[model samples]
Target: MGLHQGPDPYDRQLCQGSLQRPGEDIHPPRPRGSGDRLRHPRRERGSVTLAVVRVRGIINVKNDIRDTLTMLGLGRVNHCVLIDETPQYMGMVRKVRDYVTYGPIDAETAALLLKERGRLEGRKPLDESIIKEMGEFKSFDDMGKAIAEGQLNWS
Candidate 1:
């Protein structure tokens, strides 16, 4: 139907939570006590995250699932994405969990990952000392510590 043709009935129903896609799960977010608790503790206190890594190839996967993986920055295997354990990101991870492995990321691991994978413009590897000299932080360890502690602005 055209946009000027009033709202589509199907669209209305979906927005009102009146329609359910067959075989789709749309329940409220599960309590923070169930599976993956250790790896995805509540982020209400401070910075912590769920580390999602694509573990399998996507051959023969559905288009939507593939898209979800891409959205999470895990379009390829061995790629990892650190997402805060918020409802929104958690929901995305749930969608493509079958093709990925996820767990809580600790501070030490976060620091190490930042050193190994975090890059600057032109694909130049980012070193903590460089950032420290520029005054973004006092030292590489401080930056890494902040990141590991989920104290940096991820946005």
Candidate 2:
């Protein structure tokens, strides 16, 4: 008969402590017969080379994830970057996981990626002649092996 409802059912539940209150820790109790302890496995950090490839586009992507992709040097689709397995790099990769795919890469795969997709100044494709001209390594394979083994320092 009145325009205003006397009390809301949701507010009633909150008054009964069904919702979390400010500055208080509220965790639901586990059901009967449930396991008593929380199980968590520890992971060890190992030295490994990770190759991340951008598989998705930037359409409708959030600014934070876009910045992460930019910092990783992946500005376009199908672009890839080789990074060491570290927490900092892993965190950035995780932030953009939906737009990229990453995994451990072997020496042979690294060489192949360099041969097929590597670029240089003026957008020139990487080739054996350039490697010979630069005299950085014997060939792409050697460079790839060094990169995978963490022997090559970019900086």
Candidate 3:
């Protein structure tokens, strides 16, 4: 048996399709930015997120209640928005609780909702760049989670 058990990098370069081009060095370049780009940060298990879905019309709603709903991005009927359980948001929710329904949201459910309903004005799709420009986070799931935890206040 030889001292080296495995094939050398040069030997496998051809088989592995070497990415280096003419004049390029054999050493690969270091990755840019934080390595956490691919893998998201772990959250505590059983952490509950808050979600609100407008269940009634805004017609004839009291001025205070209507204003609260509008501020919450719930101007349209059946418009569902994810929020944290902070006292400020909770108070707003309380003001219009009669016209909406809310409950705890799990991480999986939040991801699904963000994929489907998350977006910017003018029907523009929400992506990593937009998320970064709007908030500190770069990942869509992170944005949703931060908002749910009241760490990133959209309102």
Candidate 4:
């Protein structure tokens, strides 16, 4: 064969520059700036409450995911936080989905989490007296309801 007459070094028949096989239909390139971006269901969330848990370790993780986790207050493994179902929070959760787990949290579960794991300054567990002192909600359950309804801030 001549210098450039043999089988092409990169076979277009075998590898059509994509994963599709020869017989499969290859989609055409999408037009630019068409505003047809893919949308996720979670991105259209409302003001509901969500529980995000960090299930994986930090080793070998990307810096962006780690920063998102830190912004969501999941600095350690098994650490969880209650966040509102807004677009920004949803985006952060989606960005770290591979290293975390998240879902809607009910008022009962929020109350339980507050009673068991919620801490105040100096590492004090949340209690009714503190609630009275704070002059916000009557009890842990009330506070939990406020939090679950996206009426209260975590910080």
| Best-performing candidate as measured by lDDT | 4
Q: What ranking of all candidate models by TM-score puts the best one first?
A: 4, 1, 2, 3
> Which residue pairs collide in model 2, if any?
none
Model 1 poorest 10 in a row by lDDT: 38-47
3 against 4, candidate with superior TM-score: 4
Model 2 lDDT, full chain set: 0.80
User: Candidate 2 versus the native: TM-score?
Assistant: 0.62
Q: lDDT per residue, candidate 3, 1-155, as tens digits?
A: 67877866665666778554457668756778844455434432223357889999977878989889989989898888876665677789888989999986665666567667666788777667776786577676776666556465443
lDDT of each: 0.75, 0.80, 0.71, 0.83
The true-structure Cα RMSD of candidate 2 reads: 10.6
What's model 2's lDDT at 15?
A: 87
Candidate 3: give the clashing pairs: none
Worst 10-residue lDDT window for candidate 2 reads 34-43
Q: Give the TM-score of candidate 3.
A: 0.53
Residues 79-134 of candidate 2 have per-residue lDDT tens digits of: 88888877799899999999999987789998888888778878899899988988
Which candidate comes out best when scored by TM-score?
Answer: 4
- For each of the candidates, the C-alpha root-mean-square deviation to the true structure, in angstroms, is 14.5, 10.6, 19.2, 7.8
Error of 3 at 111 (Å): 0.9
Q: What shift in Å separates residue 151 of candidate 4 from its native position after superposition?
A: 1.3
